[model samples]
Target: MYRKMVLIRRFEEMAGKQYMQASIGGFCHLYIGQEAVAVGIISALRPDDYVMGTYREHGQILAVGSDPKAIMAELFGRETGISRGKGGSMHLFDRERNFMGGDGIVGGGLPIATGVGLAIRYRGGDQVCVCFFGDGAVNEGAFHEALNMAALWKLPVIFVCENNLYGMGTQVTRASAVPDLNRRVSGYGMESAHVDGMDLLAIRALSDDVVAECRAGRGPWFIEAKTYRYRGHSMADPATYRTKDEVEEWRVRDPISIYEKQLLGAGLITDEEIRGISAEIDAVVDESVKFAEESPFPQADALYDHVYASGE
Candidate 1:
C-alpha cells in the first residue's frame, strides 16, 4: 500500500513536469495529495471488481495495476498509450483490468456505474462496481438519479465521493447548501459514511467491510472521503482562490507522510526500506517518461478506427 501511494505520488509529480515541458498535451489532472483515497479503496477490492473514476483518475488506474509506461505514453499522445493516445489523460481505460475508464464530464461516471451495477445484477454475478467522483459531482442531477436507481434496485455499487472541498476553485461551503456530503445520501435512503481520506488504513478497513456487504447482496453504499488536493483542479488551474496558509495546513497532514509516520511508529518498515522503495518507484517514473518521449504519435489513418461500433 505504501509503495502504491509513492508510485502514484512520484508518477503525478513527473506527469506535472511533463505537462509543463509540453510533452504531455490536453487537460491533465494530477492526483497528488489524495493518494490514500485511491490506494486504500482500490487495494481492498478484488481484481475482478469494476473500478470507474473521474478525469482525475491516474491514481485510481495505477491502484488498479495499469502499467505506468502505458499511462505516461497516453499522456504524451503516443500510439502505445493505454487508450491508443486518443483518450489522453481524461479517458484512460483498461478493460482487461476492469478499469471502466475515466470520464471528462462531471457526474458522468455515476450513471454508468449504476448501469454496471444493473448489469451485474442482470448477469447474476456477485461482482461489485466502485465509482469515484468529486464533491462537485454531487450537485449534478445524474448523481441524484443514479443513487436513486441504485438504491431502488439494491445494485452492488459503491459510490465514493472524493470530497476535496473545491469544485474548480469554489470552496464546498460556498457551493454546497449542505457542506456535509455524506448527509446527502439520506435523500436517496442509501447507507453512507465518512472517512478520513488522509488515513489510508482507516479507509481500507472501512472499504473492506463496505465492499463485502455490497458483494453479499446488500449494496449501493456511499462513502464520502474527506480528502484534499495539493495541486490545482487541473494543469491549467492556478489555484490562487485559496490562501497559501490553507494549503500548508493540509500539507501538514499529507496522506503519504501520515502513513509513513504510522509505519515508522509501528516498526513495520525501516527508513532504509522506505528509501529503497522511493528510489525504485522514482526509477519507474523516470522510465515511463523515457518511454513516452521515445514513443511515436498515433498515425492519422487510425483516427476513424475506434470511433464507430460498426466498421462502416
Candidate 2:
C-alpha cells in the first residue's frame, strides 16, 4: 500500500519539476502530499469500476493502473497520449481502465460519475463509479445536483472529497459555511464518512466496507478525506496564500513517511525492499519521461479527430 503511495509522491514531485523546466505544458496539478487518499481509494476499486476525478488527478489515474508513459505523453500533448493529445493534462480518458477522465472544471466529474452510476444500475451491472473532487467543489451547484440524483435513484457511486484545505487560494473554511463535509452530505440523506487522509491502512480498511456497501446496491456514499497539498494549486502558483508553519504542520503527517514507518516497524517490509521499490519506480518514471520526449506531437489535421463528434 505504501509502495503505491510512494510511487505517486515521486511521480508528482518529478512532474512539478518538469513543469518548471517546460517538459510538461498546460495545467499541471500535483498530488504531492495526498498520496494516501488516492492509493487507499483506488486500491479498493475493481478493474471494471469507473473513476471520475478533477484536475488534480495524476495520482488517481496512475493508481488505477494507467500507463505512466501514456499519462506523461498526454501531459506533453503528444499524438501518443492517452487522449491522443486532444485533451492535454486536464483531460486523460481511458475506457479500458474505466477511468472516465480528469475534468478541468472543479465540480464537473461529479455529474459525470452520477450518470455513470445510473447507467450501471440501469444496465444491471455490479460496477460502481468513484468520483473525486476538491473541497472547493463542494460549493458548486453540480455537487448538490448530482448528489440529489444519486441519492434519489440509489446509484452506486462513491463521492470522494479530497479536502486539501485550499481551493486555489481560498481556504475551505472561508468558502464553505458548514466546513464539516461529511455532515454536508447528510442533508441529501446519503451515507458519509470522514477518514484521516494521511492514514493509508485506515483509508483502505474504510474503503473496503464502503465499496462493499455500494456494490451491494446501497445507493451512494460520500467520503471526506482530510489532507494537505505540498504544492500550490498549479505550477504557476506561488502559494503565498498559506503560511510556511501550516504547510510544515501538515508535512509532519506526510502520508508516505507515516505509512513507510508502519510497514517497516510491523515487519511487513524491510528497508531493503523499500529502497528497491523506490529505485524501480524512479526508473519507470524516467522511462515515461523518455517516451514522452520521443513521442510526436499531434498533427494539425488530426486536431478535430477526438474533440468533435463525427455525427454532430
Candidate 3:
C-alpha cells in the first residue's frame, strides 16, 4: 500500500511539473498529498467493480488500473487518450476496466454511480460501485438526489468523500453547514464514517469492511476520508486563502510518508523494497511523459468525429 501510494504521489508530482511546462494542456488538478485515500479505497475493490470520481482523479484512475501511458496521453490531449482526447483530465473513462469516468461537475458522478448500482441490482450482479468526490461536492443537488435514491433503494454504492479541508479556495466550514461531512450522510439514512485519510492502513481496513458489506447487499455506505492537498486548488490560484502554516501542518502528516513509516515499523515492507518501488514508479512516469510527447495530436477534420454516429 505504501509503494502504491508513493507511485500516485510521484505521478501527480510529475504531472504537475509537466503541466507547468505546458506539455500537458487543459484543466489539471494534482493529488499530491492525498494519495492514501484513492490507493486504499481502490485497492479494496475488485477489478470488475466500477469506480468514479471528480476532476482531481489521476490517482483514482491509476489506482483502479488504467494504463499510465494512456492517462498521460489524455492529459496531453492526444488521440491515443482513454477518452480519445475528448475528456482530458476530468473525464477519464475506461469501460473495459469498469472505471466509468472522472466527471467535471461537482457531485456529477454520484448520480451515475447510483445508476450503475441500480443496473447491478437489477441484473443481480454483485459488483459494487465506488464513487469518489471532494468535500465541496457534498452540497450539490446531484449529491443529495443520488444519495437519497441509493439509500432508498439500498444500492451497493460506496460514497468515498475525499475531504481535503477545502473545495478549491473555500474552506469546508464556509461551504458546508456541517463540518462533520460524514455524519451529514446519515440524514439520508446511510451508514457513514470519518477516517484518517493520511493513514493508508486505516483507510484500507475501513474500505475493505465497507466494500465487503456492500458486496453482501448491505449497502449505501458513505466514507469521509479527511485528507489534505499540498498544492493550491489549481495552477492559477496562489492559495492565499490558506496560510503556509496550514500547508506545512498537513505536509507533516503526509499520507505517503506516514504510511511508509507504519509499514516499515510493522515489518510489512522493507526500506529496500520501498526505494525499488519508487524507482519503478519514476521510470513508468518518465516513460509516460516521453510517450505523451511522441504521440500525435488529433487531426483537424477529426474534430466533428465521435460527436454523433453517422448512418454511413
| lDDT per residue as tens, model 1, 1-312 | 999999999999999998999998889999999999999999989998999989999999999999999999999999999999989999999999999999999999999999999999999999999999999998899998999999999999999999999999898888889888767788888899999999999999999999999999999999999999999999999999999999999999999999999999999999999999999999999999999889999999878888777888
- Among these predictions, the greatest TM-score belongs to 1
Kindly give the number of clashing pairs for every candidate: 0, 0, 0
TM-score of 3: 0.97
Which prediction has the highest lDDT against the true structure? 1
lDDT of each: 0.95, 0.91, 0.89
* Per-residue lDDT of model 2, residues 66-100, tens digit only: 89899889988899999998888889888899898
Residue 123 C-alpha lDDT in model 3: 98
User: What order do you get sorting by lDDT, best first?
Assistant: 1, 2, 3
Q: In model 2, where do residues sit more than 4 Å from their true spots?
A: 309-312
lDDT tens per residue, model 3, 1-312: 665677788778888889899988777888888888999999998888999878998988888878889999999899888888888988889888898888889889999999999999999989999999998999999999999999999999999999998999999989988888756787899999889999988999999999999999999899999999898887667789999999999999988888778878989889888888989989998998888889899888778787777723
Quality of model 1 by C-alpha lDDT: 0.95
TM-score of 1: 0.99
Error of 1 at 95 (Å): 0.5
